[model samples]
Target: MNALNPVFYKEKIFSAAWFRTYGLLVIGSFVLAMGYTFFMTPYKIVPGGIYGIATILHYKLGFPIGMAALCFNLPLSLWGVKVLGKQFGLKTFICFILVAFFADGVPFLLEKCGHPHPYDPFQLQDEVLLASIFGGVVIGIGVGLILKTRSSSGGTDVFTSILSKLTRKPIGMLQMIVDSSIVLCGLLVFQDWKIPFYSWLTIFLMGKVIDIVMQGYSSDKTFFIVTDKIEEIRQYILVELHRGGSIMPVRGMFNRTEKEMIMTVVSRREMVTLQRAIYKIDPQAFTTILNAQEILGLGFKRLEE
Candidate 1:
C-alpha cells in the first residue's frame, strides 16, 4: 500500500471538524425546536415524522410535544444504533435529547422573557400559510445540518436509513412515504382536508429547503479531462490533490485513436487548483465539468469495513 502523509491522515481531539459538527447540532436542535414550538404547533401543520404525530397528540390531550417526541424517538434511535453502529447512535441520541430539551425550554424561556404568547398571530387563524412556510424552512435547515454529520434526528429517518441499506432505494422518497402516512393521520385526527393540504405544502417546501441546504446551488463539481500529458496530470492529482480516480480507455470519435480519459470529483474550491495544474501541464487539454449532486467515500463518508 502507498504510504499517506501522517498529517493528512491524523485526527486530533481539538479538530475543527468535531467542534463544527457539534456546534451545528446544538444550534440546529434549538432552531428546529423553535420552529415546532412557535410556528408548527399553533397552526397544526403536521409536516411529517414523529414530531408531527406528537403535535397532534399535543392538541388533543394537552400533552407536552417534546416529551411525546422523546418517547417515540428513543426506541427508534436505539433500533437505528443497532443497524447503523455506535457513532451514529451517539450523535442521534444527542440530537434527540437536545431537540426535546429545546422544544420545552424555548417556550418557557420566551415566557420568562415576558412574551407570554410569542406566536399569537398563528392562533388568530389567518397566518397558516406564512407559519407553514417559515416553519418548514427552519426545520429543513435544522434537519439538513444534522444530516451533514452523517447522523439523523431519529424517528422516520432511522426507518428510512435501514430500508435504504437493505433495498438501496432513495431515502428521501422513503421518508416522504413515511411522512405522508403521518399527514393522512393528521387528516383523520383533525377531520380537516385543509390541514392535509397545508401539511403537504409545508412538506414540499421543506424538501426543497433541505436539498438546497445540503447540496447548495453548486457545491460539488465533476471533471472529465482528456489530455496528451495524462501521466503528468494524473501524478499531480495523486500527489498534490490527494484524490483518487480511474483512467478509462477511450477511442477518439474523429481520429479513431486510443486515449485515456481522466475523471474525478471535487469540491468547487478544489476544482480551481486542479484546473490550474492541468492548464500548466497541457495548455490545450479537452475538459468538461459538471455539477455533482452527491458523492460518498473517502473525505465524504467512512469507508465500509
Candidate 2:
C-alpha cells in the first residue's frame, strides 16, 4: 500500500497529525533513553524491552548497551517490517534509530554542554521502588506515544508477535509472559529477588500508563437497558442528557415477553443522571452498564481522520 501510493502515505507522513505523532515519538524516545541511561541502567533495573537484555549484557559481558541494543533491535525491526507492514516498519526504524542515538548520546551531550550525569539521585534516592516507578512511567509514556501512532520500535513487541503467532496466544498475554520472564531473568542473573518485584512493578505501571496515554483517562459507561417504559427512558435521555441512542427488540428469556433495549453511551458523570432518570421512569428497569474506553461519534470525539 505504501509503495503503490507514495503520495497518500507521503502526505500523511507530513501531515499535522503525523508531525504530532513523530514529535511525540522523539520526546518519548528521549524519555525512554533517560529511563535507561539514568534510572534503569545505572541501578541495574531490568524492566524488559531491548534495554532489559542490554542491561544484563552491559554488566555481565561489558557490552556497549547502545550498540547492543541496536544489534538486538535490527532483526526485530526488520521482522516488524516484514510481518507488520511498511508504515509500521518505517516508524519503528525511525523510533529505534532515534532511541539508539539518544540513549548513548544524551549523557555525553549533557556532559559536553556542562552538566554531567548527576550522582545525587543515584546516592540519595537509589531505592529500587523509585527507579521502578519513575522509569516505568517515563518509558510507558514513550512507548505509548510510539504505539499511539500505530508504530513500534520492535524489541519484545516483535517477540510477542512471534510468540503469539507460534503459540496461538493473544498478543497481550504473550507480551506479559515475555516481560515477566525478563524480570525473572533479572532475579536469577543478579541473584536479587527484589529485582523481580521492582521490575514487575515497572511493567505493571508501564502497561497502565500506556493505556492511559493512548486511551485517555476520560471513561465512558455504555448502558443497555431492557425496560418496558421505553418512551419514558428514551425521552429522558434525549431531553435531559441531550443524547440519542438506538432501541432494538429483545425478548426476556424467563418471561418470553417482547421488550425494547435502549443502548446508550455516556460519560461517567452522566451515568448517575441516566440511571436516576431511568429509575424515576421505570423502577424495575433492567440495565447493564459496561466500561467504554472510547466513544467516538456525535456526542463524543469525532473519528480520527
Candidate 3:
C-alpha cells in the first residue's frame, strides 16, 4: 500500500507537469500565429524563417501563409528526424501544427464573418514600423515561452542543425547565415530595400525581446569583493542583506599576498545597499560588479523551474 501511494503521487505529479507544458505550448503557438497572421503577413515583413519565406510566397503567389509554412515545416521536421535522429519530438510537431492551424483559421473565420481586411483587421497596414515592433515582441514572447518548456516550432532551426552537423560549423553562425539568406530572398522578390531594412529591424527586436523574456527583466548584479574585513563583510551580507555567498582564498597578482574573496549576487536595489555597507566596513576593499543575466538556485529562481 505504501509503495503504491508513492507511485500514484509520482504519476499525478508527472501528469500535472505534462499538462502544464502542453498548455504553454498551445498558447505560445497561438500567439506566434497571431503575430504572423495579423501583423507581419499583412505588412509583408519577412523576419526570416519558414514563416518568412511563406510571407514572401503569400505576397507573390497568393498562397495561404499558414498553409505554406506548414508545408515547409512538415517536410523539414521529418528530414530533421531522419537525419538528426528523433531530435524533433511530439511536442515540436504539435506546436508547429497548432501554429499553422491558428494562423490560417483566424483570418479565414474573420473573413467568413464579414470583416473586410481579415489580415489587417485593426487597419495598421500604413503603420509598418509599429507592426514590425509589436510583431517582433509578440513573436519573441511566444518563442520564449515555448523555449522555457524545452520545445521548438521546428523550422529553419532543423535545417540549420543539419547543416551544422554536416559542415561542423557553429549552429549560431549557420542559423544567422540561413536567416540572412532568406531575408535577401525577400529583398530580391519584393525589390525594395525598405523591406529588408524593416525585416532586419524586426529580427533585431525579436532577438532582444527573446533574451529579455527568457532571462526575465530583473537587473540582478553579481559582486566580487576582495577585502581585509572578510568576517565583517560576510556578517553584513548574511545578516543585513539576508543573502548567502561564497568565500574563496586568493593570491594577489601584484602584491602576491594571500587574501579572501567574497562572491555574491543581489538585486540591483540590494547592490547599492551592499556597496555602501562594504565601503563603511572596508574602504580599501576591491570590488568588481557585473550584470547577472540569470541567477538560479537558493534565494533566487528554483533549480527545478
Candidate 4:
C-alpha cells in the first residue's frame, strides 16, 4: 500500500507480458555469471559491483562467493523494487537470480569436465593477464546485452538510478561516478590493481557497445537551410533525398528580414546529394549541419521499440 511499493505502484510481475522480458534477463544474467565464475573468478579477477565485493569476501572467508553475492544483493534488490517500481524491480530480480544461479552452478559444470577449477588458475602468473582481459570482454558483452533490453544488473545500478532521479542528473554520468568508485575501492583494498583496471575498461567498453547495439551504430547529419528559393529546394530534397523536411518561418537577426528555414535528416552518404541540390537552387543559401549519432525508424534501421 506504500506509495513507492513497486507492486502497488505498477503492474505486478505475474502479468503474462513480463514473462518474456524476465526470461531474457534471466538468460543474459546466467551467461554473464557463468562466464565470470568459470573464466574470470578462478583467475581472481574482480568484476564491478557487489559481485566484486563477493569475490573479495569469498577469497577471505572461504564461503561460496556466488552465494554470498546473492545474499549481499538480496536486500538491495528488495529496496530497489520498492523505490524504483515493480516492473523494474522484478526484472532486476530475474537478473540477480540468474547471475547467482550461474555463479553457484558454473563451477560444478567446469569441475565435472575435468578442467582446472576457477580458483586453481589464480596460482598461475599467466592467468593474471588472460583472466583480466577475457573476463572483462565476456562480462562486458553479457552486461551490454542485458542493458540493451532495458534491464538493470542491480547493485550500484539501483543506487545510481536513485541518485539520478534525486539529483536530476543523467544516469550515465551517475553510473560513471559510482562504477569508478567501485573499481577504485576494489583496487585499493584488494592490493591488486590489474583486475580493477581491467574491470573499469570492461564497463566502459560494454556501455558503448550496448548503446550502439540498442540505439544503432549509424550516424546522421541534420541540415538547417535559410534560402530564397524555398519551393525549389523543397522539391529537390523530395525528389533526390527521398526524405522528409520541415520549414519554419524566421527573421534574420541582423537584417530583420523574414525567411523560411528548412530542416531535414539525412544519412552520411546523402550529404553530397543534399549539397548539390541546395547549390543548384540557391548558391548563397545559409546552411548549417548537425551530427546525429543514431538514426532510427521510417527510412532508418531502428531498434525495436
List the candidate 3 regions with Cα displacement exceeding 4 Å: 1-14
TM-score, cand. 1 vs. native = 0.68
User: Model 2, 13-77: lDDT tens per residue?
Assistant: 57797788788878887777777777788778888878899989888998766778989898887
Tens digit of per-residue lDDT, candidate 3, span 218-270: 68999999999999999999999899989999999998999999999999999
lDDT of 4 at 54: 76
Model 2 lowest lDDT segment of ten: 116-125
lDDT of 1 at 279: 93
Q: After superposition, how far is residue 208 of candidate 3 from its true place, in Å?
A: 1.9
Q: Summing lDDT over every window of 10 consecutive residues in candidate 1, give the lowest-scoring window.
A: 5-14
Q: Clash pairs of candidate 4?
A: 42-118
Per-residue lDDT tens digits for candidate 4, residues 1-305, read 54664344333467754665566667678767865775556656665677777777777787676788788678877876777666465567778777888887766676787867544534446656566656666676677667755677777777777788779999888877877776776677768757666676656555665566555555689999999999888888888678897899999999899999999998889987898888888999999989877766677664444
Worst 10 residues of 4 by lDDT: 2-11
Measure candidate 1: CA RMSD: 7.4
**TM-scores vs. true structure, each candidate:** 0.68, 0.85, 0.91, 0.74
Identify the candidate with maximal TM-score: 3
lDDT of 1: 0.83
